[model samples]
Target: MQPLSHLESFVRSAESGSFSAAARQLGLTPAAVSKNVARLEAGLGLRLFQRSTRKLVLTEGGERLLQQISGALGTLSDAVAGAAEAGRQPAGTLKVSMGQAFGREYMVPLLSDFLARYPAILPDWHFDNRQVDLIGEGFDAAIGGGIQLTPGLVARELGRVHVVAVAAPGYFGGRAAPTHPSALAGFDSIVRRSSPTGRLRTWTLRGPAGEEAAVEGRPRMILSDPEAMCRAAAMGLGIALVPMPFALPALQAGALARVLPGWYADAGPLSLYYPSKKLLPAKTRVFVDFVVDQFHARGFAERMSGAGEPVA
Candidate 1:
């Protein structure tokens, strides 16, 4: 690697247009600045500057060298500054991946406050259902359910992802709600088809007392997306098995009602996944902490775990 001192002196002299001015900037003697530039030129086998009695002017090669090296020097300086700042504060782009429905419903709403708290950190979020290769895709973090933990990746559980059956209030206007998981078999249901396997899914539900039942429904409509299934149920199509996050809003709005209340399918933990780097970026650290804090504060953990009692 070329000496940073040599490159510094060369760039400083080029920008200042004289050895003496560059010396003032570097806190070095004019002679030392001139020596460093001369050494740099000799090392590169080029005459970088044409010296007159009045001022030093760039030769054609000098102009090209300046154009090339100036940007590199700036980049190097920025890298050094960023490294130093990493110890001091969270700053820079915070790239996070999340499911579209979850991010929109949960995270995007909190961004205003997060940004206000950390003005230096810019949020770059990708909303998609596909499991991203966090390191390979250059993502700082991800939040979702059922993300397989790969080597060098660590996960912090935000909560459990439990699936529950729900339907529009109008759908159950006259019909009685299912009192148990087995009763769900009698209802017309909107169900998910596994996107990867292309097979219809059965809802395997666990009651509050730890009873498990797999209910196969007469599929009124088969869909893969959870949001779509919830919407279908909201339109009074049929009961839908959906993640609690997707169902909660409609449930709260009274657009939908929970069916077989205590029974839910345990999909697994919802987690925030990030690289297990020894020195995590401050941006990633703060973001992870912030979101986790919000989840706990909102009782999202409990709600996601199917603790929120269904409305009668």
Candidate 2:
């Protein structure tokens, strides 16, 4: 098959009726344009032009070829230009995956302002507890912690994932508040079961002085979702180890009290995950930047670290 340049040269030369005019349009020398046309004719095994010193005339085959490819070339050029324009302008359906509780609590609130700013961008969000295959599942972005950094994916750290023990203030009425991680084992605990592994999740808390202690929560209620654990704790079901992002509102509202203020388990970094930065779509790029900026502006990283002032 002839290269696109060859087809372009032939088409332009035919349209202009002169090699020099085609060369001027293509930003090439007349000789180069003639050579490209000749190469195209040779590849096609059909003479496409009857050349003259004064003007170039299209042969029967050239006329047929021109008729076949001219409109197609225009359409291809339009498609390319449209794609480039779409890249420059942030306007598309942005599909994002995030945790159910975290998305509702944090990201969903940002939608009003985000849509107001980029009115052309339509947000399609999926809320779930498990990690999603960003590229495979055709997701624009995902927000969560502990997601494996698979090949072809990039993560921007929004904050640290810290799990703090929390429970209703009344649940601690008769029993003494646990000062150490080991003491958590004696209380009625609401623990999460790993979604993938189906095994009980354990907590290893790190103190301010770098002391580590394993928490063996005696599970009165075994749940799969962190938000459910927080709700259970709020209902005075048991002491629950919940991620700060899921537990923050309850703590601030006095619905739940921090069990051990000085200790928290560093699960991993909460991140915005997307495909590689190369030729990243405008919608995804803006959304990533917006979320990161918002997280920084709101001090979400520090507040979710469990090292902030007690919220109970």
Candidate 3:
């Protein structure tokens, strides 16, 4: 029988279409992953992949074997990991993916404490602007908003993300601040272009009276990132609608002022996502618990919800 490691190497390489990608996910050298796959092939007396300089093409036999073993291998691996480390300190590289701005501003602050508690765990975090495939990419966890919940995954809601209109104090140049969402159209606006769909994003603001108003700016500037929009607004460019998390710092620093303080757009929930397994990994479990605790203790949920803002 081939070792589980050999099978894992083969499966991961096939799934990723490259030995180097598999190696990165597995935390192994490319040479080692290739050697393991070679060993598995030799033992079975069959070629699993037709390798080229660019990518690995799975052979017919490889496809059949993968279909037969993928689920079983995952089950076995989860069980083995749980049973083997039931009482042991979780010590391994913990891979996670998160949005760059949110991860840097919020999640990164927790690193020091996380490391202090689990000194043996090494953090390997990837900061990205887009959603990532958690299980397919072999990430231990991810954090963001608006991620579609796929099979074999679960989410823990962190907070309601709210979008508020803001601008530099001097942006309006003595023009009266907008009293309603509809008034925003008369002003120059810094807006966001949706990354996944190449369309301009629109905002609908909800008022205290349960009334809603759809609004769009004059498109003085367009950016793909919320953080950048916040910065552009702070630089006296134009009014911008940005998520509370991206605007909080500037708002706190008095660099930006709310445009329509009584209204805000309901974006979505920020969440921590991970694979749903019968026996979750110790590192992931601890990290999840710690984050939930921190968020509650810090009142981040309320702050991000626009509930903490004083109504004008």
Predicted model with the maximum TM-score: 3
Q: Where is the poorest 10-residue window by lDDT in model 3? A: 303-312
Q: Is candidate 1 or candidate 3 better by lDDT?
A: 3
lDDT for every model?
0.83, 0.84, 0.87
Residues 1-312 of candidate 3: C-alpha lDDT, one tens digit per residue: 899999999987887788988898778999999999999999999999999998999999999999999778878888998989888998888899998988898889999998999999999999998899786678989999888898678999998889998899888777777788888889899989999998999988998787999996688988999889988898999999989999888888888888887689889999999988777788888888888999888888877866446221
- Per-candidate TM equals 0.72, 0.72, 0.82
> Model 2: residues >4 Å from true position, as ranges?
1-83, 86-88, 310-312
Query: What value of lDDT does candidate 3 attain over all alpha carbons?
Result: 0.87
| Candidate 3 runs further than 4 Å off | 38-64, 133-138, 148-152, 169-175, 195-198, 307-312
lDDT of 2: 0.84
lDDT of 2 at 54: 82
Question: Candidates 2 and 3: which is better by lDDT?
Answer: 3
Best by lDDT: 3
Stretch of 10 with least lDDT, candidate 2: 73-82
